[model samples]
Target: MWLSGAMATPIEDYALISDLHTGALVSRSGSVDWLCLPRFDSPSVFGALLGTEEHGRWLLAPDQPGARVLRRNYLESTFILQTRWRTDSGEVLVTDFMPVKDRRASVVRRVEGLSGTVLMRQELEVRFNYGTTVPWMRREAHNGKERLLCIAGPSAMVLTGGNIPHGSDHRHTGQFPVRAGETVDLELTWYPSHRETPEEVDIDEGLARTVAYWQDWAGLCVDRKRYRQPVRRSLLVLRALTHEDTGGIVAAPTMSLPEEFGGSRNWDYRYCWLRDAALTLEAMMTHGYDDEAAHWRNWLLRAVAGDPDDLQIMYAVDGGRELPERILPQFPGYAGSLPVRLGNGAVDQYQADVVGTVMVALSRMRDRGVDEDSFSWPLQRALLGFLERHLEDPDHGIWEVRGDPQFFTHSRVMMWAAFDRAARAARQDGMDGPVELWEALRDGLRTEILDRGFDAGRNTFVQCYGTVEADASLLQLPQVGFLDYDDPRMLGTVAFLERELLNGQGLLLRYRSGTGVDGLTPGENPFLACSFWLAEQYARTGRLAEAIRLMDQLVGYANEVGLLSEEYDTVDGRMAGNYPQAFSHLALVRAADAIHSAEAEQRLRSTQPAEPMESSP
Candidate 1:
């Protein structure tokens, strides 16, 4: 029920629409609050999500006061969003989507009158370069159709439809009344300002083709009776975050959505992180999407196409490596969060776990019958060589802490996983490599971890070699096969995490920030991905009841259209951090798969007859 000129809406109120290049966040009240053109990391054209409406936004809703959202949901198996609004006079439906396979990037909003005549309003303020530059506006005829064109610097966008808005004071405004059975369609297209303006798209044809493409992709998922809807939706979110042409998957479509609202914990997540992308690939591969897995693998090969010693933990969507972090001070951040940032500084930091994550995912693909090309295997060997040279190097760890580097237990275990997977590939799959050396290195890591990482007195593994802290990332130990889920050490670590990291509402925090481990403020919401990892651990350990209860609670946090953010604020009961986060959704898919597997096992046990009782004397 948010209105224009008001403070930004909660993170959960936004739904995502993507066309495989860039994405736009549409608020529940019918506003495009955030949109980056050309690519995921491009500058924003609708930056109202992070600042005032004057920054930039597109508002399309009823012109009447108290016109509230009745309901909203995405069309089945697709990112097409349909929202129904009810005013005092009548009802209307708004459909929003970005057509796939289109030449120009565009957003299509179609409005249909469902009841009595209702008046609709349209307001657009296009600011390029993250809301810093207002575009030069003009009206021109393209293909005999009058369109409003806005050009600024290198970016240009055209607004075309039956009802073109009139501009005044750098804002476009229009109003029209629609009777029942009538419809109106508006399209916004972005292209290079230096090039010729693009033509108007065929809305009906684009819509049909987009729907078919998504449905066809979703049809490839393996059938799951339990948690099917959320799984399917989560899988689609992961796919939506992926760039089709480059095969690079971004962590999220957003930049600087605060992890802690009104705090300095915000960081950009628009780039492709190797760990997140590899995990996303594994999740998709588990559900019968090997083609996507191979595509991402090819992307990996292209991204790390140089000396492995220079490999970065993340890269741009097109594999560009120069990501310099900077702040935009002109625009106030989301909910007063300051210093909205662009680009990720963590690209320069060494995270030991990333190589292990990539190796494990590639190994999974190989096990699933994916043949590595000439370039892929050699690149992996070079990566192992780099790892061998940096075997004793301290790392910033998986959370990418800004604090001093340490030999994190999770990172070390993943290092072990890298060698283990390489050895397995060499021995079992006949992949050429130094299997003996890999085995020796793997064993050495295991011995060192057991000797230094574990706290035998507490029967738990510590966060690092010298710290006694329990990190929620420890829950992933069993995930990488570092230990059995039911191992005493893992159980002890889980119990410690529950006691130390769980908030009042039983959600998990990444770690105790008060320990200065992250070198930041001590307040933030519980990370959704960590909680999902806990759920997976519970299911794997035969705690089916607990796992289902936790899974239900976590899944319930998803917004109206089955989208989850990076974290959930249990105190305020709202989502925090970036919207439609790839990490959160991919972890949800894995957790659901674990729970489904546990449930099937439980059913099989129930169906089995008990063994005949022994009649011993």
Candidate 2:
């Protein structure tokens, strides 16, 4: 499915539209080059973004190749995309969105004439099985309406509209004219080939309902005095990546986008990682989406229902356990990044941070008035028991390092947090549990970390038990209650990270790849989440001006539509890694909230009388 000579559009030039179950990426030029069927991890029905239009694409644009894109934006907090195109003779508006209220899986594109007559062109190429199979297409009448039906091995797609493109060389092409005050609608739907073809839906009505659905959900966010728009947009993206029925949140919608283009760092993030989903739930709860938290907790229960020792780091959307990684040779990948990947091999690795992350999130949920039933409490106790079995084991760590396992400082700290939260829950929250045992475990781990994980000469915590390299993850020490924000040890660690991890543009990299710690190529962009964590740390330690400056610079990296990728290439000034990463956005919300809270506190202090200063002895 790799393009032979076609030049693919830049990743930044595309916008996303989703139906909650799946998403479609549309370039500004009005070509939908990437779309998955049934679910986020399903096979692509339109994958031209990874290849070319010849592989699969549905384009609706001005017939004039010189048409200029005037502007594009989502419809007021919703994923409904509106792009206006201007030609020398006239102008037109293309509205794209996936209907959410309906059961049918479809995408609707409506073209409206905004000015004088404009010639429009429609091209349809439906390639099934990741663009490796061209479907057999034919024109037919379905439900007394003319439609273009395409059939492949087990999947079928039908295109219903007034202007049916004629077949030409296994592709469909047509030209139509729309005068002022005219409109044309096109809808494409997917269904199993064995089942009856689904009926068409009213595109206008569906768009209205979808818009309301998103705005209503977004309206629930607690008002933020600063960065409200971007916060709202990030929340929307997280919702878009979540599976509505299953309550499983995906890290990103697309797979094999590459952490470093044309490098071997590519991975599939379509499945639900325990740590990522837990952090996402924490973000949602912070923004007043407690209902989502409850749902995801139930999903976790089902996903990890078996023996705690057998639990995986990730699971499928429906709570299935198996996710074997494999390479898709057919796809040339984004920007010639080869061997597109599906599933994830990291699921099998032991990431000790995962259980601690989940425990912390559940603690937050409890603090927010979520009553933990027997099911949840017992499950947590069992997870703690599982941790007890591996108290001194090495793990893959938070970054899922492919190298030999090590006793990562961050992972050990998180395990301490897990035991600490459990003890607090039982003693303070009046929850039933073994509090004394938990406290002893927590204290023992803390002493061990300070003794073995700290580099006393440098006054900094190292990446692992023996390494001298510092990790940006140390910025999270205050966040998880391992240490005070202004603790001298933490401040020293921050200084070391700023000196070693910051790129020339002052953005933070996850770690120095050249250290040979990750067991891969020695290059990657600055991780956006790590940078956000630094902003949060600054705010907590009373460095208000420094925090504000870094927060502003970090948010500016978001694309034009307010979506952030996992990493940013400071040198090249473009996004890297998976597009619209959940971790990046969640960290953004927390960082913005920190700044808002700090500003409010500062304002209140200025209005009140200061306490009398005590004389130093």
Candidate 3:
């Protein structure tokens, strides 16, 4: 099985919990394979996802054989995750979370007995920088309390919790039997090796504060009479993606897991994409998260404050702009896939669509009542002016093509969107500078795309002009509102895409294979975000039943933790690409919104009275 070694846990066995600063992926078996501490963009200390046991991991679970798990769910409205494992002997619940208490770095894993007596085991291993660094460790005392401080060249981690025993070769282990109501907590903290150890954390208070913080932030979601559940979850995921202190949002929580297993298609996705972050803001605004909108807006300004031409497509969570990509040969990779990577090289790519995405997101933020104050208006205007000069250029599209730049049709459409939204902003909001000329320019852009981007003979939109292949991203046309969903050409494009991009599993790939648009090795799985796009397109085009069915199927692809990857291996029915993608979560929100819309309409009609007395009076 392709998934046999590729997976650390079965798709049915994991849960995620986070502080919006970092996340942990915990298996129902009580193993944590993926977690990057200190920050979301930080190098992983527990990176079993990219490689194997040598890469680092932590486990705490019943030692009994064949312990079938019962269930797992986040504590209501919080990042605290609880997974229950029911064995013939007893029931045990494990709680995992990275606390935001005091703004210091920490991960706390707690195990509790919920039923009859059960014996549990704990294993802890520490490696730094994608498992390339082997830390020096010793058991020590901090303020007369027991702690194990593991020190690497530049980084260090201090661990303190319940009595976890230190073993040879730096591994930590603890095995104990507990009856109903017994509990244990394990805390791990990372800091600079040369620096003094962090202050002792009050585990109880930190746990309470982290839970309260997530619940409070989740309460800020903008909701209406619509798809409340998925919308809330998407909002929660977005909030989890956001860096609490700095307003940055990481693209996803992992990297090098591959869009196709054992293939070289894997690339790091741990940094912040201006485009993705901006689109997330749009999603949040739609759901009434103005405060987050404002915070992200501030983060955006800080991240791309330089000359518009110097702006990077993405950035570090601290607004750092220099992320030079590199490969890690030490870790064996997820199931020996080899050559684990860090820091995205796409930062150097000229994805023209990025500017348009930013403009559209900013426009949405402004439309949703986020006032563009003096600083904001000037920055947006400057970006628009920059686009005016470079709008005609063809660089990489939204796919971040590795080969050469092609005139990607979607890129052209987004350029049109950028100009159109800017023009709308100027005309309606009275923001100054070349509104009429930009409107004219915007119309010219739309005409250019219609002329070159569409294939009249096929009655469909191509991935790029002169290329016959269909792109899953074409589904984005209605999303960005480039055309009405019912347009004949749009409907035709949908059909062509359905014919070409649809895998047997009913999800869409980024594009068909024959064209080689990505300019890399071919044959990957259906992208989860694109699959959700299919549902959104279906819903918007009045295929409500089909849309609902497709949405349910797509959501089902999410792992047991309610976390989705960037793509799914259609052949093997497993997740691929970077795990826990923000794009996927946002798509869930959009599709759920569509499903709830139909339900609301049905309810409204059903509730109406059969007869009315109009002329009696």
Order of all candidates by TM-score, from best down to worst? 1, 2, 3
lDDT of 3 by residue, 163-199 (tens): 7567676677878887899987788888888888887
lDDT of 1 by residue, 61-134 (tens): 99986699999998899999999998888899999999999767999999999999789999999989988999
TM-score of each: 0.98, 0.97, 0.94
lDDT of each: 0.91, 0.89, 0.80
Question: Which pairs clash inside model 2?
Answer: none
lDDT of 3: 0.80
Q: What is the Cα-based lDDT of residue 457 in candidate 1?
A: 95
* Candidate 2 Cα deviation (angstroms), residue 306: 1.0
Predicted candidate 2 versus true structure: per-residue lDDT over 241-293, tens digit per residue? 89988999999887877677677788888889989999888888898999999
The better-scoring model by lDDT among 1 and 3 is 1
